[model samples]
Target: MSLPPWISEQLPENGRVNTKLTQRHVVETMYQSDRPFFSLQQIQQRLKPDVSKVTVRNRLDDLEDRGIVATDPLADSLTLYYIDHPESEWPLSPAGERALNRESAETGNPFREFLQHPLVNRVFREELLRSIAWAAIGLFGWAILVSSSGQLPATIWTVVGLPILTWASLTVGTIGVRLMTGNNLRVQSTEGLDTISLGGVVLGGFWAVFLIVVLDWSPLVTSGLYLFVTATYLVFYKRVIRPRFDASVED
Candidate 1:
C-alpha cells in the first residue's frame, strides 16, 4: 500500500506534489488490478478524468525505467505492461533487475547513452522490426533471382522446403523442452549450444551438397537459398512461434 520507493522521494511544498500523487496512483492501479496486464489506452481509460494520456504514458515510462513494471510486447497486439511483484517493498525485484540489465545491454555504446530515446530503444528491440527485415530479404532475393534468371528458379523449393522443415523441427523441440522443464528454450554457446540450430546446420550441409551435385544446382544459388531459408525460418519463429511461446510462459 506504500508508494513505490523510487517514487516516494520527498518533494518540497510545490507543484511537484501533483506529480508524486499521479505517480502513486499509477503504481497503485497497476498493483491492485486483477488483470495481469494493461495497454496504454486501457491504463489511461482506468484513470479517466484525473490523468491525461501524455501524463499516464510518462508515469508508465518512469515506472518501467525504475523497474517497478514489466512489459509483454506482441507483434500483432498492443504492448502490455504489468507489475510483477506489487507486494515487494523494493521497486526493483530480482526479475525487474534482470529486465533492466537486459535493456541496458541492448542499448550499448557509452557515448550514445545521452542520445538514446526510450521509443527508439523499444522499436529496435521489437520482434516486428526483425520480422520486417527478414521479409525484406526474402522479397528482394526473389526479385533478384527472377530478374537475373528470367523466371522463378526451380531451386526455390530448396529454399522454401528446408526452412519449413527446420522451423517445424525447432517448434517440436521447443514444445518438448517446455513441456519437460517449463521454461522457454534459450540459445547458448559452446557446450550449452542450442541443439536444434546445430542439427539444422549439419542437415543443411548435406542438403547443400545434394542440391549442388545431384540436382545440378549452382553452388551460389544453393548458398543463397540456404540464407533465404534461414531468413524464412527466423520470420516464422519471431512472428509466430515466439509470441505464442512467451504468452504461454507468462500464463
Candidate 2:
C-alpha cells in the first residue's frame, strides 16, 4: 500500500502538507492504482506517514461531501472511495460539475480545459484508436504516392500541400466530429496558439520542407522523421506534462 515514488516525490518530506494537497495525492493514488475503489484504511495505508489517517479521513469526507468521489458502504460498515467521473452512475451534482469546470478554466490553459471537456473526451474515447489506425494507413499510402511521383513536384507538394492538408484535416475533422455528434463546438482557448506555439508550427513545416527540397532528402524519409518527432512529443506530453495536470486541483 506504499505510495508510488512519483507521487511521494511531489509531497513534502517534513510535517503535514495542506488538506488540498493531501486530497490531490489521494486522488492521484486512486488514479494510478489498478483497483477502482479503496477503503479508508487502504487509502491511509497507501498514503502512510506523509498524510495521517485522520487527515486522509477528513479529506475523504470532504471529497465525498463535494461529490468529487463516490462511495459504497459495505455490510461491515467499511466505506470504499473512488474518484467520480462526469459519466459515473452516481451523477455529480450541478455544483460539483461547476466547480470542476471552474477549476480547469482557472488554470488559464485552454488546451488543458479542452482536454477536460466531456465532448472532446467522448469523441476521442470512441474514435482515437480507429483514427490512429486510419492515419497510419493514410500516411503509408501518401509515402508510396510521393515516392512514385516526379521528385521536384513531390518535394513541392510535401513542403506546401502536406502541411496545409494536415492542418485542415485536423481542424475540420475535430469540429466535424463534434457537430455530427449533435454537440455544440465550444472554443476552449485560443491562447494555446499564442506566438510561440504558432511559431513552432510554422517553423516545423519549413524545416521539413528544407530537408526534403534543399538537402535532397526523399519525401518519404522527411515525412517519416516528422511523424517520429510528433509521436515523441505526444509520448513526452502523456508521460511528463499530464502527470502535473492530473495532480493539480484548485484549493
Candidate 3:
C-alpha cells in the first residue's frame, strides 16, 4: 500500500530513508486495513515477502516506541500488535505528534506529559465526569439509606464531603489501577472504569462500617479527616509519585 506524504514528513531525515519507507508501508497497511490486530507473520505476509523478519520486527518496535502501536499479550503465548491511538484518528494526528515530542522532553512527569496532549486530556476529562456522576449517585443512595434510619448527620459533611471524596477517590483509584495494569491512559478503554467501580463498592462498604459503626467518629471530624487525607495523597501522587514513576518508564 502507498503511504501518505505526511508519514514521511514525520520521520527524521537521518539517511534511513529506505528504512523509513519500509516502516511507512507497514503503518499504511495497518492503518488502512479493517483488521484490529495482526501477528508479526501476518504483517510480513501482507508486506513484500522479500522483507527480512528482522526489518519487520525492528520497524514494529520503532512504531511502538513512538506510541503509534501497542502490543497485546494473548493467552495462547502469541502477541498481537495494533495501532495504539484511536482507530478513527490518524496515528500521526497533530495532538499525537505533540504528545510524542513532549514525552521526550518532559521526562520528569508522565501524567503531566499525558495531559499536555489534547486528545489524552479530552479522554481524561470525559472519563472523570463519568466517574464523578457515578460517585454522586453512590453518595446520594447512601444518604437516603442513612436518612431512613434517622442516623443521618445534620451537617454539610454528609451532603458535600461524601460526594467530593467519592469523586476524588474514584478518579485517583482509576489511575492507580491503570498504572498497576500497565495500561496507558492515553489509549482510552472502559476496563479501567469497570475495575474501579467494582473496587469502589467493596472498599466503600468496608469504610462505611468502620467509620460509622465501629469508630463512630463525628460527622464533622470524619469530613475533615477525609478531605485532609485525600488531598494529601492526591498532592503526593501528582507532585511526587507520578513524576518518579514516569521518569522510570522509557518512552
Please give the CA lDDT of all the candidate structures: 0.57, 0.60, 0.62
lDDT by residue for model 1 (162-216), tens:
4445445544554455445534334322223336655866787776776687657
Leading candidate by lDDT: 3
- Residue-wise C-alpha lDDT for candidate 2, range 137-218, written one tens digit per residue: 4565456556656753567677456655665576568657664664533312333323444575567677688668866789
lDDT at position 205, candidate 2: 74
lDDT by residue (81-198, candidate 3, tens digit) is 8776533343344455456646655665666755554444544666677686768676876665556555777468877777778778878777666545634444122344345545
Top of the candidates by TM-score = 3
- Mark the 10 consecutive residues where model 3 has the least summed lDDT: 12-21
Worst 10 residues of 1 by lDDT: 9-18
TM-score of 3: 0.33
Instruction: List ranges where model 2 is wrong by over 4 Å.
Output: 1-21, 90-251
Off by over 4 Å in 1: 3-15, 18-21, 86-251
TM-score of each: 0.29, 0.31, 0.33
